[model samples]
Target: MENNNFLLKINNLKTYFYLDEGILKAVDGVSFKIEKEKVLGLVGESGCGKSVTAQSILRIVPPPGKVEGKILLHQKNGSAKKEPLDLAKLDPQGKKIRSIRGKEIAMIFQEPMTSFSPLHTIGNQIMEAILLHQNVNKQEARVLAIDMLDKVGMSNPHRRIDEYPHQLSGGMRQRGMIAMALSCNPSILIADEPTTALDVTVQAQILELMKDLQAKFGMSIIYITHNLGVIAEMSEEVAVMYLGRIVEYASVDDIFDSPLHPYTKALLKSIPKVGKKAKVRLDSIKGTVPLPLDLPPGCSFYARCGQAKEGICNKDTPPLLEAKEKHWVRCFLYT
Candidate 1:
């Protein structure tokens, strides 16, 4: 049975890709729960599986990749009964998953241009999703799409809706992407590096728009980004990932004030302080990431961690343990 408190629960998810050389474990035994109507930030470096985990939830992982374990969506039935659906079991291309993908859980992909078709206008793409999910005709869907575009702060939405994606500026296109994702009023939104390509001014505006829309829409958000600054500003809870595993999970204040895991500490230290002296070199996390195919035994971060003990840290993989009230960390020191 699904709990009313959680919107989605991911349990020990493992997404692996079969390659000619070896199997690459992109997401290895990651687990977490998204609370209802809250923002959960997934932060990590590139190739740390933040994006793959989001794709796995929607069963959209690319070919040669296998998604295992449970992705339970706590959905309500017509009679007010609860039925937990394991999204991993649903056929990716089937009608059921397709209906649930955009209607219940929407995604704002990293690149709007790639996600949209250049041949069609933004209105067509947004209205297509609305027509597929909602009980609306083409004309009504177009109205709804334009309304959504306006809500996301698109200027001259009626005029812009007919314009092709290339005709719009980068920020306008990003807002259009948000409009497309939110057109159906999904319960959950997955934003994968939503502001990565925008300038600082535009990025702040987009962030504000997202935050405002999240409250108005009453949706839980899975915000995946490499920028800790953005995470601090937008998220209520924070999950720090490394090499496909969540090493630290805590409240935003806890993550910033007192990070427990060695990796999390190193990451926070690498950030340049606002008041620091000029010409001071920022501290960087030492050691390169281990190859996914040939991950070392025991703790994967053993080599990079400065506080690692030879035998203890390299002997066994540490489990994600709750060390404090509502604070979890995966490390030998905490274990």
Candidate 2:
């Protein structure tokens, strides 16, 4: 059943790449929802399928990566198609997905330079998305793109739109990227580590800009990052992923205050806390993350888990179950 309140619900999603060595499960049975106008945080260490999950939703998983299960986008009230659209079912390069990609959902990549073409002006790139999605001409799209640049706090939006990606500073390039993503008025914005390339001051400004835009446009955000501090500030709910699966799902306050999974607890401990002794080293999770080429039969996190029981935890994988009200965890301890 489609919930009216949620904008998107990804059900039992699994994205796997069939490599020469073995099948690499990038996202294994991950499920989550984008609640209306809510900022949903997907946080984990690198190579934990955070980016792959976002790509799966947009149906942009590269060749040889097979994505199974439904990525349902629940339509807003009184929209053209009342029924929910399954994005995973659509052809990646087809017109249907293309129509939805920028118009209904847009993404801001980690590095703006990767997305921005050096061959074209910033305005040309921004206007491309607008012109592709909206029923507007080149002139109208240019006007809209310039207005979006201004909205994202790009200094001298009019003049800077003509500048190349290299011409602008890191922060400015990011702002231009944001301008392009918002040009089509997308309902959901997937930000994949969008601030990591910039300095802390620029990072704060970009975050604040996103918050303001989300409110102004009533947009739902899927924020993927390893920074817990950013998650705490921006997310109402968080999904803590481990080894390609969500190990814990809860409110931000619950995650920080009452982490149930051992992995979740360890992750919190690893963060540098206020008033810590200057001489002490920051805590870190022991044991390097195992390769995902051929997954173990038991829990994927079993090897690195501190509280693992030899028989129970290593024997089988634990399903993500509700350990408490609105708090779900996957671990033998909770089971």
Candidate 3:
């Protein structure tokens, strides 16, 4: 997406985890911008650092995991100059980052059960988020929480507000998590595989709910998922990541119709399509993701890239080159 109206600008972000063997570059030099009220799809296989990039924006990486590079937040004031708060430079316990967590930037995790407090009632958790972010009384927070629950399409929201997480259905709990995330009307929302654990029908329902809420709230979204189908439904612009770097980025239609990068093409071909001659075979990418600690010297996908050239692909890292207007890919073939 265009960076002119950017809400969150992440430049060359590197989040490294210090391990016994060496530093594991979970997110290495990842860069992307999310514009105001736009959806940016981050599609990749498992361990491709999509989730790590989202977490880095919020500065939520656990201990021994260090993050670097500029994370600029564009304020609502319509100024080109970014807020002085560099997310990477913020102290872990500082008030600036803490103040922005639930209010300015919120995240919806893959599993709601794991995120929710098992002992606490759903109402209590949602109320806590509201109360912490806004200077509202207990009664006001409860009312706001119930209103949010209703907004997220929960049934009998007032009654369900008092119920524990275990009492709600899988879809309901997912809705509840979305409700909590939106309670403060954050400027940016990072949804990390929000529908992964739900049934197909429920997944559609949750996706619809998220889109509706996005329209209502006008918040930027960073949708991180492995499913290209979900990316097609939710995002306007899509970035295909391999290993720890973005291999291709373009509008959703462009990526799907004319994918430039070999990895992106392979992923699209691997998807099962209807109305096609039923093949006893399905396309699959060979090999597994390389270990983060000992990534290949050059392009991480060189080992499995069918289009890889002998010396060029394995000797030098390819820069992200423009393939078309507003379309970019990292490969020697294009450069």
List, residue by residue over 59-138, the lDDT tens digit for candidate 2: 88997998999898975443634778899999998998888888788999989999999999999999988888789999
The reply for model 3, stretches above 4 Å from the true place, is 1-4, 76-84, 272-283
lDDT of each prediction vs. the true structure? 0.87, 0.86, 0.86
Q: What TM-score does structure 3 among the candidates reach?
A: 0.94
In the predicted model 3, the residue pairs found to clash are: none
lDDT, candidate 3, equals 0.86
How do all models score by TM-score? Answer: 0.94, 0.94, 0.94
lDDT per residue as tens, model 3, 1-335: 34456778888899999988899999888888888899999988888888888888888898799999989886555467655356888886789889889899999998999889999999999999999989999999999999999999999998999999999999999999999999998989999989888877788899999998899899989998877777888999999988889999999999999999989888787653321222212247788777688776778889988989988899888999887999999999998
Tell me how far the alpha carbon of residue 224 in candidate 2 is from the true structure, in angstroms, after superposition: 0.3
Q: Where does candidate 1 clash, by residue pair? A: none
Weakest 10 consecutive residues of candidate 2 by summed lDDT: 273-282
